[model samples]
Target: MLQLASGSSLLAIAVDRFLRVRIPVTYKSTVTQKRSWMVVAICWFTAALLSFIPMFGWHNYNTWNGTTQANSTSFECRFFTASSRSYVVNFIFFGFFLPLLAVMTGLYCYIFLTTRRQLRLNIGAATESHTYYQKEQRLAASLVLVLGLFVVCWLPLFLMQTIKLYGPKIEVSSLFVHIGVLLSHVNLAVNPIVYAFRIPKIKEEFKKLYMRVYHDGQQH
Candidate 1:
């Protein structure tokens, strides 16, 4: 659910940026704060809806005619174990991941290209054009870095889950699972780094928090 939410929320940002680039004149009017919040809310709600489908017994009905047991005795609940093969293998990887990847990639690429072309047209005519272009590129770089990190980190876990869902019962190392989980979580750390560079308020608060934590540790 967290991954789903993250991906969807990022997609909203991509869409917002796309609107900003493709329609600058109308961007502010269309992409208002209320609308932004609405989009985020919709993304989270949709993510939760899709993520909880397995829990709501959608996974009980398999791809075939087989019906899964409603109850289990297992203490440790793994996603691959709890989820249906269809949900784990097909829907998440194919339906969500691939489509989201394609859409976000397309949007960011379009935004970069469009802005670059526009800047080039105004190169000598506008003195501030270079500065604005650099700003756009920096923002684009950060956005891509965050998205790329998410993809790189989560791909391994999804692949592992797919293999576990379909492949023969082979004892895989828990270490590998833990590593995959760690990588997926590491994607989250990129957000703070990007925010620190982009938003001064957040950067100030982060510095304060770090100093407070370090002082407390030293006192102990």
Candidate 2:
């Protein structure tokens, strides 16, 4: 549920950035500060409701039998291992795939429209628009990189899970599942660096910090 809400929030930001660039006047009126907060609130509410529903008897876990127990611990709990394939399928679609698809679509569409607009600008407007367009292009490229990283990190996990659920029965090694999960987690670590490198202000701050550390080392 948290994942769903986070993805939705990111998607909203991407869409908002695109609209601000493409249709500034209309976007100002339609996506006001209050409206943006409202969108976030809605995402949170929806995620909470979906997540809470599973707690009300949808989730199935393996039952412990004394003879069949893997360990002597009586408090052991294993979730998502039961015969409830439907729950897994629904989680994949709603929690990951749908939100990812929406974000990717919005980002690519924004890139396309920005490129078209750049190409169509008149000579008279070129000088006035050159700096603005350049900045937009940089930001868009950064976002594209971020989106690519997101796909790379999550796609394998998503695909493997989907296959495990829907494909022919086969033994899937725990090592393979662990690797996929690790790759998915790598995104959380990489995102901040991606943003810092892409944004001019953040990049500048990074440079300043680097220089400060370098100078202090030299003095010592």
**Best candidate according to TM-score:** 1
Q: Give each model's whole-structure lDDT.
A: 0.78, 0.68
Candidate 1 Cα misplacement greater than 4 A, ranges: 59-79, 124-130, 166-174, 198-220
Q: Write the per-residue lDDT of candidate 2 for residues 61-170, one digit (tens) a residue.
A: 44322333446565343333442445545575656566667766767677667755774674346564665666666677777777778777877766666777778496
Scored against the true structure, residue 91 in model 2 reaches a CA lDDT of 72
Name the weakest run of 10 consecutive residues (lDDT summed) in model 2.
Answer: 61-70
**Which pairs clash in model 2?**
none
User: For candidate 2, what is the total of clashing residue pairs?
Assistant: 0
Query: In model 1, where is the ten-residue run with the lowest total lDDT?
Result: 61-70
Model 2, which residues run further than 4 Å from truth? 63-85, 94-96, 120-126, 201-220
lDDT per residue, candidate 1, 1-220, as tens digits?
A: 8888989988987887788677766878888899888998999899899998876675644622445443567544354544676686689888999899999999999988988887788777656656666566667777788788889998888887777767759665767877787887877766778768775667899999999999999999
